[model samples]
Target: MVHFMSFLIAFSLIAVSGKASSGFLYPQFYDHSCPRAQAMVKSVVAKAVAKETRMAASLLRLLFHDCFVKGCDASLLLDSSGTITSEKRSNPNRNSARGFEVLDGIKSALEKECPQTVSCADILALAARDSTVLTGGPSWEVPLGRRDSRSASLSGSNNNIPPPNSTFQTLLTKFKLQGLDVVDLVALSGSHTIGDSRCTSFRQRLYNQSGNGQPDNTLDQSYAAQLRPRCPRSGGDQNLFVLDFVSPTKFDNAYYKNILASKGLLNSDQVLLTKNKASMELVNLYFFGGQLSTWPTT
Candidate 1:
């Protein structure tokens, strides 16, 4: 990294201590331990995203999959071993969650800069933040100093990460379990603005949404028609569709607008508008005032 890319992150979490503390994460944990750590991560992520714009969303997804199970300990990054079963094989992550090689590149750089000083958990967090900003999203200071899990939990991964077909209640319940509220759910769902979903992930919405041989009425008929060609009833499970049809590669509030227009690609997404009022208001808040980035940090 000949030229360091500096991003001043004024967002910092309170430091905690003691074994009983709720959190021990700190945004500036690596300031002295590895001064170049964040910059190194940004450099790699910028290059990776440059080669493939979608890589930004993929990297961000890795963080979500990891944190949903075991609280961002990087257990999702582990490989199956003598006594450990990798979370990669979990239903939510199997053949999905990607960007491990990008993390490996980041960890390798951090190790070279300060051997044993950086943790995989921190790397995942930083990489996710960098990926978001690279895709024209807001940049936030991520908490660091977390450790990687010794063992991966396949069952936890499957049960934790909300599926694309989850109802509004299921999605909110999952977020509540994580100490997040409805606003968090709607705001986080906005991340779909930059990602792609496999045909299988949302094929149910295209057809047979309620097992009556009808497509999800919540989805715009035209969008469903566009999806049906590539994603048939039983095949082409791997076909990719931009989650947000309006601005697929940009990280913004278009996802909320899609939900409003009934063009939401996934069942879980449309539910934000149809199933709940608070979330719907948040969606409108973002779509109408999306340019302000008014998402509250609760």
Candidate 2:
């Protein structure tokens, strides 16, 4: 599982933080201007994760959502102004998106070191890599030099991000629209190994998953029962449950294991096993051990 996660995580990062040329981005982009730039990001992220381990996953998720809509451009950070509508107001990010304060700290420190030398988009990438390492996941060399977008995309955020209740095919199509493949989808979804999902995110699985008054059969009955009290059929929407109950604070393959055991918390997760043959196979590959021809390196 560890071996596979190392590969998946690298793919997750590389595939997400992708815009690099024309503008010319690289790992060494900050070498001369602010040599301590990456370290500052790591330090801020380390402290945040230490204070709240879930911050690691939150940072990572923030990176993914930001990059998906605007190609790692930090448009996700924008607030509504004259004509700009903040992505934060979108359905996908509403109450779920977080770690902005930690990001603000990193940005503030970087400005002190060298004003505007590091971009928020690059900070997102570096913090995500740092968060992964802090949470027992692999590291990747993040390409820097991504410029923050001046605009936010509310419609894009609402339409692009795959919702928690997305069917397997819907998830794949959304990923594909972002230039990601089946492999990237599976790899990135493995990030569910850490973090939490709000009751509102997965409440449908607990009751009336298919429009009928019944829980999702793929979700283990016992697990649903445990979730029902705090995550009733209605309300209690903000309550959070660990995505991977086995190692909630660690970035590992336990998420895939939970799916294998029919304990996946969200419909999107459980559908990987119950709805798609290829996705199910990938889940099994990630859960059990597997061989890789070549691993991604820094």
Candidate 3:
């Protein structure tokens, strides 16, 4: 089994052995080692996204979850074996996270082209950017040279990745712990513009949020009414709803627009507007930014 120690060793070697420029990742990390690495990853990611549009969102979320747990080291990709526990079973993952098969396919293709030359960590980062682009989202140059971890962290996965029910301040603190600020939180939350959330993820808001039996007051009553029949108080845990009701598959700022209108899907999402002034301003900025390019780059 791949262990966390192996990841540390790999990262240490790169940092100390001068394999990467002063230990920092760059877009050109694979230029000499495997010239076609990025192209291969993008091709595989494009094919996966074509098969199922939601796969793009799944892949993007997968990278986010991975980065949160272990600094984008691909610890999330390790499978369970012996004493090593897989992060897949963590609270934020389990039935919620996906797109592993897509990663496997990309890894297989890369191995054939250049055996062990590309790390799964870098594959995830590249696939995430490609997935975003394939889904009509913004494109950015991803820094490469991340090494795959040999171990997974179930505790870190659970503790680090914020849940759908997290309060606005809790979510902000969680992002801050990872060295991200309000701008990053709001910008990254724009990913919700393209994905689906399970019924269980938001059902608490529909039936009894705050233990009050009444639905969350922040949720638009009409929208909540529309959701209850399909989501229900029980069963349908796996039933899916678009995170962004409008432009569900398009990677735009519709998520912020929805939140501004009290139509955001999850408690965590709606709280961005309801619970904090800074977050509300970010939401407004993205809602009116009109395009991904216009949103804050910081």
Candidate 4:
């Protein structure tokens, strides 16, 4: 009962409508299966990532938020003003306004192509996977057909997401709760290869530790020295960025390999390799031994 081509027709009209102004097309004219409709979705998402880092970050964040909490419920995609609550966060919600704009872009394109036939939830899932590949993570085909959520909850922060300091056990529990197996956890963590966290988020591992062969200590001694100027005492403007200078913006298994070499960027990342058998096993397979080349195959 989904007409796909109409969605493309709608987007083509928007493209032709000129850059000065564009709005939703007639709902009656929307379709679902059109290749153009899918193309519009891809095109709009790409434009968002190109113009706004926050937009891209938020999309990836939403995917992690959803999968870690409620099995990819797409709950994080809802706007707070839209008659719903959202999950909680240790820090204030860093919801990016640009993220909403990108969502709108997708919604508008879909509306022109298929009216309201496609759900916002589906768009959210697709956007997350699309965002991941854009940021140099593995590409996996996600099945579509998700429905829009009517409400958002601030309480989702409680048990859904893992904090930067979460222990190995806690991280495993969090991911397992989301229906992801150990392999998925290791595979997904590769996301850290891009982006950044605040310096204060992981300074304790550097200044407070008794010399352990930790990557934070080996952080290009020069890089660590430069960070001190910005993070002074691990507070105020200590936010660390997660960009993997070696391969920024290319989806690959390099992140896993970094862990084996003790180049993990965060304490949580390092802990996965050092603590617990299940985690160590996966880390060894992917990071230590380079088994991720055909990961998810087993």
User: Of the candidates shown, which would achieve the greatest TM-score relative to the real structure?
Assistant: 2
What lDDT would each prediction earn against the true structure?
0.78, 0.86, 0.80, 0.55
TM-score of each: 0.89, 0.95, 0.89, 0.73
List runs of model 4 lying over 4 Å from the truth.
1-35, 52-57, 81-83, 88-98, 135-137, 209-223, 238-240, 288-298
Q: In candidate 4, what are the lDDT values of residues 1-298, reduced to their tens digit? A: 0112122222222221111112323322224454455456667888888876545556766656654444445555665564555553324245221265687788888788777676565566667667765654434444554555555556666555777767777777776665555555555665666566767566755564435535355344555565566666536554555545456555445655666666666667877677756666666665444333443321
Q: For residues 68-146, what per-residue lDDT tens digits would candidate 2 score against the true structure?
A: 7867899999989998999999999998999999999999999999997898888998999999999999888888888
Can you write out model 3's per-residue Cα lDDT over 1-298, one digit (the tens) per residue?
Answer: 1122223222322221222212578889899989999999999898888899999999988888888886788888988999789999998999888999999999999899899899988888888878877877666667777677877889999999999999988898888887777766766777788989999999999987459687788999999999998998889999999999999988777787799989999999999889887777667765664223343332
Q: Quick one: ranking by TM-score, best first?
A: 2, 1, 3, 4
Model 1 off-target regions past 4 Å?
A: 1-23, 290-298
Query: By lDDT, highest first, what's the ranking?
Result: 2, 3, 1, 4
Count of residue pairs whose backbone atoms collide, per candidate: 0, 0, 5, 35
Winner by TM-score between candidate 4 and candidate 2 = 2
Worst 10 residues of 4 by lDDT: 13-22
lDDT of 1: 0.78
Put down candidate 1 lDDT per residue, 1-298, tens digits, no spaces.
0000111111211111101113577678889989999999999999999999999999878877777777778888999999999999998888888889998999998899999999887887888888888887776667677876788899999898999999988998887776667766776777788889999999988777568987678888988888899998887988899998898998777777788999998889999889887777666776765332443332
Candidate 2: C-alpha RMSD to true structure equals 3.1
lDDT of 3: 0.80
Candidate 2 ranges beyond 4 A from true positions: 20-22, 291-298
- The predicted structure with the larger lDDT, 1 or 4, is 1
